[model samples]
Target chain A: MSKAEKTLLNVPKIQADFPILHRKIRGKRLVYLDSAATSQKPRQVIDATTDFYMRYNANVHRAIYELGEEATREYEGAREKVAAFIHARSPNQVIFTKSTTEALNLVAYGYGLKGPIQAGDEIVGTVMEHHSNHVPWHFVRDHKGAVLKYVDIDDEGNLRMEQYDELITKRTKIVTVSMCSNVLGTINPIKEIAKRAHEAGAVCVVDAAQAAPHLPIDVQSLGADFLAFSGHKMLGPTGIGVLYGETEALEATEPLLGGGEMIREVHLGRASWNDIPYRFEGGTPNIAGAIGLGVAVDYLTDLKMEAVRAHEMEVTRYALDEIHRIPGVRTYGPEDVKQKAGVLAFTIDGVHPHDIASILDVEGICVRSGHHCAQPLMERYDLPATARASFYVYNDSDDVDVLMAGIRKVQEVFA
Target chain B: MADLRELYQETILDHSKKPRNFHEIAEADASAVGHNPLCGDRVTVYVRLRDDTIADIAFVGQGCAISKASASLMTDAVKGKSRVQAHQLFQLFHRMVTGKPGDPVNTAGLGKLAVLSGVSEFPVRVKCASLAWHTLEAALESKKEIVSLE
Candidate 1:
């Protein structure tokens, strides 16, 4: 193991941050390996939600009362923390939507023009994006009559940037990809690709949903015109997320959802829209969710993103080394552990993925089974689905041990 | 007490290791494909018939324990039975998998298959346990190339 692998944190304090870890399930400890779906919130974020509800629960913006003013300031302060975390220039560029799904859809619907996306104008994307990225892009393509293209992935799950170079040209309007593949956990080279897209005058959108929790993200450094990520995936509350769009990109788009707050003036004949961030944000925001997300951000900052990534690296390197030892077991993605994130997908020789998942479940080990929302990628590999175990900061070597013992049990059971 | 998990008793494991009638019958009367997308298990079943009676059946594919065991058990269960009798057995086998106890698919006698009844406890594995029967039923209903329960 290298220095990055040895950089694991003194993470004993992490259990205290998440209260639910104290709870028992089926008379045993809960070994949550599904952090890729949603993270368990820290106590601070949970308490923050309770505090907001109990003390100063009021709508943000255009409030005169004391509670409302306090609520507004706190909410805006949360936005600043988010902006700073991602290294954005200002909070004005950050748009708070329900999730990465809604954020990507807002861009697909709002910024897309009919004429620019003529009969054959190309929109280049990759095969590894989550359904949150795939479906919305399809919605735009169908409506605008644009051609959608996919950049091939190598057998190792790395993007074929050379194929991307051939596919992208003056006709390419948008290039969207996942920063970290959810199923394969391959951390993509977004900065280099974003530069490539910019050279061709195409907007770049990065789905940073899986990256935000494990890896430190800097939107400006990545040079993406728009990026989307969900809070729930980052140890925050569900139904809240951050969408970072370049100020110029936001200014060029129309309002996504029409309602009370996202407007300047309305008439019997026509209605004008609000500015960038507010324009995209519709009425009655997820106030409590946002506040909880702010608390989650604080919790992660306190833990240190570098430490989190280090611990994950230690666990992943250990897992990758051990999982292949089983007879007939197969793993997918970049062979270099450093090139991967916390997710590891594999198949056992005699056992199917669902059978593998079921056998693991008996030992109180949780894992995901199936195509993992990348059916096209599955088709590329000629596979139906795979069993995946993903890690986060909360996971430890013990989790990996439980997983190892569980796989051994499967061998014993089938023996 | 029969350990249903031991339905794959030492005997079942032996059968799975060297599956009997695990081939394609060139002069088969009907054939079908079955797939389980969740686990990537796919198999083809071919049935050879003489007149209206069941003659020979074979299967080929890659699968897990439940599917391979079920296929091996199926080849053992259906040889020498007539088409109508095979449908009756297929119906009972279907009910056992789908958890519909009183479906018309049940026949009076399926002794060793009762071990498979324990499989109904695991809903997801039911398809894995019944892939061959579903393909047999599909072959009886339509083209025998591949029938999907996916």
Candidate 2:
């Protein structure tokens, strides 16, 4: 692949962004398709991180020095960019957490743990969700004595929207759902679900961890009270995630972790929270991480969300068509690729996904095999596991073709 | 084009296809289940013990060729060995998979297992290849003929 061909997407002109991707796995060029797990970084994001460490390395929100002020400015400024990226009302609404997993847990502990979830109250979730979204709600249900409600899925992994409509009722205080299914690569109708949740007098929380990276998300348009997404999945850094919540709703929720930077008046016996954003942030923040996230958002915006969504749909369609044609290979998720993200999960006949993955690794075609952390969805389909190849802006049709070739090779070996 | 020779050796492929001791034993002393939740490879190992020695062992579950074959070969290897010997084999196999003791490790008694030593090169696959052995270790510890899937 030429340098120009690699830059067909917004993956930067230089290879220095992520040094890790350059390393050989089994002596072949890595065709990494596991971006759904975490995306590779860009030069700008990586340099932004280094720029902080070299010039402005200081603990944020504490020092009176100039570096601290500069760091805080950049960090909070990054939050503003993230807020704008998802069309949040203000930077105050963005709470930086470790990952989308932590963000969801924050909601579970901070909000759901608080009383509207009574002994008989209900919280609704879909069958297709990453464990980050699923586990936290189950934790709430078990601890709070709340009834857990689940929405069914179609044969192709799409959620049964009618069943979801029937389930979301006045008794439902929390209607948390994934904006997209990680394993199925199915993009859910989050705006419609959010509207329904609002109509039913329940607050809607969107697990946008998968969706934020692949599609356009307008939190205002979606009308979701809270939205959660991770930085790494969006071509940013790990240990940096965004949780978008309306100020009023966030105020009602208690902070998940307790420490400095989250309090207002500290007394010997008791303490009071600072405000909306500070209430959620309880410790020294990841300053450089936020800057990397800012550059990532800038990178995504430069490509334009509309183009990103369109390109992925095209890639998804090509992958689905090509992989489906391979004899003895079965694909999961929507055949009509426009209905989903670039993620595709499938299995080879008489070949377990692990074996397929091992074969693919030799060819330097990295794809995720196994449950994709949605065991419930696998059970829903009566499948033990799947081989998943997800695409991002960095991937193109050639990558899919390479993957198709790899799959054929796997079949040949097992056959 | 990338050659499979760098990764999947001929011996590993053969063992994966027609794995030894794939059938269940009529009588087993203990059992353990091995699960790689990442790949959803599940194997339940059953062992029959005659005093301190493993009288017979069998495994049953759905997994990739590597896991199934690895389990099959493992069951056969431990069927008649003493429990202490089986544990040592498990440790040695794990170390071999993780690339310890260099290129030509002492396979002195490992026999057909020497074929799997090639798996050491493919780091990600080590888990898939070792799934069966992890269960074997679990089966040895518990007196129950059947144990929980790891």
Candidate 3:
């Protein structure tokens, strides 16, 4: 057996670490293929969260009690872990938010609205951005009277890089792009895109919500001024997300919310902002969720992201080959496995995506059926929606086999 | 949990495959579009009203089987009814689909729409079944804004 294939055999053992993977739906074993929406948590991550509440259960960075000290230590410890995970220079660059949506909104409100973006300035984005990434820029555009421009996708779902040459210029103040597409699983060349944006003297913001879960992300290597991702999609608890900004970038941007923890000293009408990361993290943060996310990061670090990516690529390649053999199935994104991640967005002839999802549900197969929060991408393809099956670390070849069977059942029922 | 067979009943499948009155009425007296942004399901409901009664009703759009069947069956059920009667039927259908688990579905006067009572078992699908009916109500009232079951 090949070295990669030999290591991938441990996938079933990895699947056993997740409590929900053992669940049965509709009298059949659950075949969860919707990790792109949100991933199932491992017992380690869940236990870490529960342990925080049960043991510490104290507000962070406020009280002088031992429990509060412990909570604050764990919370700040998580920031260090996140910084290391993304290869950031320091933990002070990381800010915790409720979700990736909130993180992106923070950037839009702080950097785009209050910082450098001005009237008639242009912001560049791609057609494949999630609404979280796309709409915030709209807010910037509407409030600042800035023009919003999009880098379109080609027939095979690849970004038209030539358009970047044409659209991005000195007029562009900010260039935001998703490191990976949520719907098409297109792995963008952010390094190249960021390079181009830098040449034009524009800051590059990356929406790494999809990419962070499956790929190894290095903020410095990608040259992202700001990067955002949610912990929930990467085997961690919900209500906790990370926003990494360079020191210079965070210093230039203002905080979106004002209150305790964000200000150094408040005197009636005047208040000085806190440090780089703390200034952005207003109010009491999701301390337990952050602690859990740190453990989740430790888990990923133990497994190594390269192995995870290789396993997913193998499963996706297998699924793509098998799906093409089915007469009526048309899968989206780049045909080459190397160019794509684990997302399989497909449509069946004469079958609506919702119907396919419903049938798959009967077989205890979980799949996403919707516009995937990328309505612009849907419009570009002239499609209402597509059935998507996304893979993660726990997913194996057996899961793909079950998915194939479920899809065949959908066709049979429709026939 | 309700069986998939119950949700995708033979009649529902048949209607979805070849929806009745699946066309736009020329010079529609009242028309409204319904959108389920969650699943990208869309249906445009058209009504030609004669005084207080519906003289004709047709629809055109793309949606899931549950939504398309719901819209198709809804058009048939309310075709000849008065505006008040159609509104009453909509209320009845809405309650039936949104009712809690094991709650007795008040199917009396619901007729063909009782088939959609299975939707209540699948709570996530409640919006899919109701999108068309909401659009129908918008059409009857001649609401210019598109109806949305967000």
> What's every prediction's RMSD, in angstroms?
4.4, 3.0, 1.8
| Tens digit per residue, CA lDDT, model 1, A1-415 | 3223354575557876788877664445777788998888888888898999999999998789999998888888889888887889989998999999988888887776522356667788999888888888787778788889999899999999899879998898888999999988999999998998899988898999999988988898899999999999898999998899998887767677888889899999888888768888889888888888888888788878887887787889888877766676788887676789999888776656776776676566788888888888888888877889998887877788788887887666667
lDDT of 1 at A142: 85
Clashes of each: 7, 8, 0
How are the candidates ranked when ordered by lDDT, highest leading? Answer: 3, 2, 1
Candidate number with the higher TM-score (1 or 2): 2
lDDT of 2 by residue, A1-415 (tens): 2212323354443344567678887677778899988888887898899999999988887889999899888888899999999999888999999889999999988888873567778899988888888889888888888888899889988888999768987788888889888888888888888888888888899999999988988888988898999999998988999899977678678888778998988989999888878778898888888899999999899878887888787777777777767788888887777678878888888888878887888789888888888889899999888889998887777788889899988988876
**Global lDDT of model 3:** 0.91
Off by over 4 Å in 1: A1-7, A23-28, A50-75, A113-116, A324-327, B1-36, B43-63, B71-110, B117-150
TM-score of each: 0.84, 0.93, 0.97
What candidate 2 gets wrong by more than 4 Å, as runs, is A1-23, B1-3, B100-102, B145-150
Docking quality (DockQ) for each candidate: 0.28, 0.59, 0.73
Query: Tens digit of lDDT per residue, candidate 3, span A1-415?
Result: 1222544537877889999989889889998999999999999999999999999999988999999999999999999999999999999999999889999999999989999888999999999999999999999988999999999999899999999989997899899999999899999999999999899989899999999989998999999999999999999999999999988888889999999999999998999988888999889999999999999999998888888888888888888888887999998999887889999999999899988998899889999999999999999999999999999998877788888898898888788
Clashing pairs in 2: B29-B47, B29-B48, B30-B145, B31-B145, B31-B146, B31-B147, B33-B149, B33-B150
Better of 1 and 3 by DockQ: 3
Best by lDDT: 3
On TM-score, the stronger of 2 and 3 is: 3
Chain A of candidate 2 compared with the true chain A, TM-score: 0.95
Best DockQ among the predictions, by candidate number: 3
